[model samples]
Target: MTNPLLYWLWLAERPGCSAKLAHRLLHAFGSPEAIWRADREQLAAADSLSRAKLDALADKDLTYARRIADDCARLHIDIVTADAEQYPRQLLDLSDAPLVLYVRGTLPDFEEQLTISVVGTRRATPYGLRAARYFAGNLAQRGCIIVSGMARGIDGEAHRAALEAGNVTVAVLGCGVDVCYPWQHEQLMQRIIRQGAVISEYPPGTEPAARHFPARNRIITGLSRGTLVVEAPKKSGAMISADLALEQGRDVFAVPGDINRPNSAGCNACIREGGAALVQTPGDILACYAHPRQPGAPRARKPDVRQEEQLHLDSPEVFAAAPRTMRTLEGGEPERTVWQAVHSGRHTVDEIVNETALPASDVLTALTILEVGGYVLRVGEGFCAADDVQLPQQTNEEPNLG
Candidate 1:
């Protein structure tokens, strides 16, 4: 358990040895202990084993192997080798999944559950932040544990909002689970370790680098049922995660943003190219879950306009979904963030949330209503605006997109 595989992974840490080589070794050797016991001729005879790797396989790499063994012993961390019941099934679906996963806390129910990965740019706008919070908060209430990188803007917002809702959130850190990057979110990291979990593939003391984040992004989207991109520039880390999510057979949801806004390009492109679904609110996501938590109780909303808007979007079968708060807006109800977040100027979910201080779930409900009425348009990355016709803020006021 603590020999060749650990050493190879440690050598994998040394720059250019690919995880593919690690996999090949796992396949041929059967186990780390077996690979370590193999003589030099036996090592040389192994097919597809790179010369650089084979040469370093002798006593040279033994010390590092022993040290990692000692480190794991001291930390009491369990290593989930590939194909175990404890291994994350979501990862198995990927073609090049990691050979071993080092987990520090209780793993979530990946086999029976569908985790949603929400990611976005680090330099997020107020709207991006608010949208992340609202989505995380509402998703948590709906019994969905949010997954993010724990970077400053959208990622941090998602984790914090989930925690605030008295739920768990998983942070897939680029560095070691015990380390915190950017320093600003250190306090938040502690909270996550207490309420949820922080995980990484890097050894316990590794620091983060630009290269680590892309691989880290893969884990964030790979381990979940889906991925949501809230806000991103044309060149953003969020887009990379979105790409990986698609490659992993996970659903991709991108919040639309303003075309004129430079920060929204990635999300807008995703929506246009059909790489992602245009997610207007949390309801849209929860509906995808097998057994949604709250299911948005009807009693919480007002009867008139909300109910009528439901009628507008309703299939002929249902007739009227229910008497909810959305029916009151003149042009339509604020049914989803696509419609609700748009005001005199384009607004982000954060602006809406801070001004209204409403939970994102309620905001999602309102946005759905307005979107049905055609009063607003989802321009890009949670940005919404009057759709050529500004509907007056009606008696059915939209909740702020906090």
Candidate 2:
């Protein structure tokens, strides 16, 4: 008989065996130890393993599994199986949960800790980035354990914000726990492991592929009480994460974004379709937790002025700033025309099209140019002239996104 830990590793790494099939075998046999001891006839009787697979399993040696166990010991990686006492309670309830999890750092006590997932598009806009930092920082200060994929843009921003706020954050990877996919984030990954953990279902050498991301996303939401979409396109990995959150009976929250921005389109759509609740501040998300606030929450800091300009959910503030940022476009006829429409209060794309009597594409192109010049700012679903916009006066009070 092989070592118990080796058997578990072997069950997950068996050739041609899918995670689903491995899980079925575990259920049929009672344990990895029992499965390892089962004869070929019994293995075949499970009805899922092919004849060739049965032969391979029956004839295979434990040499490789032994090596892997040794490597993990030397690397300080923890192998958590479904039956392990240290396995996350939240993941066990998931239907498609991984058979085993490879963890490179200390795992938090999910049963006692408040965990939330923050996800978004890799190509996050400046507005989306600010929102991610604001919410994540505030939530971390309140003792929440932030979870994310550690991808670029919003994911990276959220993790950094949490750590910067003197709290912990978990980074669940699409690749191996040892392999950092976005090479540039190697340092950030180390920072995360120190503060929280880096975990994955794949073995230590597996590279991140396109197909691995959706599978990875499931774990992100599975580990949390709720999932937050900071920003995402209509068709993106973040939307897939949101769908998984719904499937798992978890709450979904989306930070509202401008309707005209492609990166924000999915978030707005999620809100409109009633798939997620709109969140303006970290407190809104914190309210969803069933647990009471932990005593001694960290002191809050002043909100960034740039974030306030972009989040104009209240009707009074949406158009409160006078059109003081407006300026004559010296560049092209299209820029001047689009500026005129926005300055004239034809803010929405449809309104601009109607007022300018120009094609939607032309209007959008002109708006982009004007926006780059600091002449326009997005407010809700409309465009606002930035001329009269005043930076909010700094206050000693703690910042709130609303």
Candidate 3:
């Protein structure tokens, strides 16, 4: 008799046997062994597989499948099927969950762990990079396992920060578990394997493909209790992850960014559409896990890092200070004059334009600069001093992107 696990690998590798179709076959036949033993007539009766696929499954040799399993063992990788006890329970909730995960490091008890995915675009701004690090570090210190796509920019920053805090971080890859796509992240991948895990549904030696990424996203969001978008454009893979998380009933958090920055537009849109919560600090994310932790998992009672000075965007003093060398704004006079108008109870664009006596374009430009600079907040129907915006304390000089 063939090894039951080998049958699973063969069935999974069979051409045209999509994840959904494989699942249907499993549900109908009880197990991979049963599915393999069934004749073409029985499979056709299942109605989900095409005749060509059924023939392909019936005729394919297990040589390549066996080679994949052997390669995993040679490289110290583990093949975890959906039916395995080590499989993450969160993934079971996904309708199109992968049948197996090629794991290069230890798999955590996702049911017993607090997991959150941090995702964003490759072209992240300094603001987005900092936000990713701050949130990932604070959450990791508090015992939440950070999950990400292991891509460049935000994802890499989040994983590195989490590991730096001596916490577990899982990287769900778009390629095979053994292959590193970015190549620059080879060293980073090693660090993660030492401290956390690198997992993928694609078998070893599989190259990263365009189609694999969106499918890769479901697993990232699927494994976590929540997904955080640190920065993204109006349309990007990060938003897809956010959408997938929401569909999976996972909490979605978007770090507020400058309104004028294109990198932040997607996050801002998500907030405006009521699709995600505005995340100002790690505390905002921590609050989402209101449910009790896993029975055996210990929650960190003491703060991991010293509480830093908090700054709200709407602080009157902050808005009052006229920066002598501000470059993001057109001129000091326009910004200060506009700030005073809003501070003095002029709310709407028309109202501020009327009161400041400045041209409509100038008011609009200043408002964009002010909001981006974190000096003003867009409340419902009106603008206000950004007094409620909370940001982590300052230590290093702010990056000069200009």
In terms of lDDT, which candidate is strongest?
Answer: 3
lDDT of 3 by residue, 1-402 (tens): 666778888877888778888888888999988887888888888866667897886874789888988998899999999899999988988878898899988888887778999999876654566678788887888789999998877898899899999999999998998899677678889999999999999899999999999999999999998889999998999999999988877778887777877878999999889888876667666654654557556432322222322321222222123334433323377887897787555767888999999999999999988888877766434466443333334379898899
Q: What TM-score would each prediction reach against the true structure? A: 0.68, 0.73, 0.74
lDDT of each: 0.68, 0.79, 0.80
Indicate the TM-score of model 2.
0.73
Supply candidate 1's per-residue lDDT for 359: 81
Which predicted model would earn the best TM-score?
Answer: 3
lDDT of 2 by residue, 1-402 (tens): 556888888877787776777777878888887888899989999856777789767855788788878877877889988888989989877866788899987898887778889999775654676788788887888788999998877898899999998888999999888788677678889999999999998878789999899999999999998899999999999999999999887778998887777888999999999888887776666655534535464211223445544543232222222334534445577877777677655657888999899999999998888788876766434575554323234479888989
Ranking by lDDT, best first? 3, 2, 1
**Candidate 1 lDDT by residue in tens digits, 1-402:** 444456544544534456666566657887655666677688778755566666655544556555655676688655666656887877876766776666666677766555788899776665676678777777777678788998877888899889898877889888877677856677888888788777777777779999989988888998887888999987889999998888776778887877876668999999888888776666565455434435333211112334334433212222112333443345323343334445533355666666556787766666655556655444333444442443345377798999
Each candidate structure's count of clashing pairs:
33, 5, 3
lDDT for 243 in candidate 3 is 94
Residue 328 displacement in candidate 1 (angstroms): 31
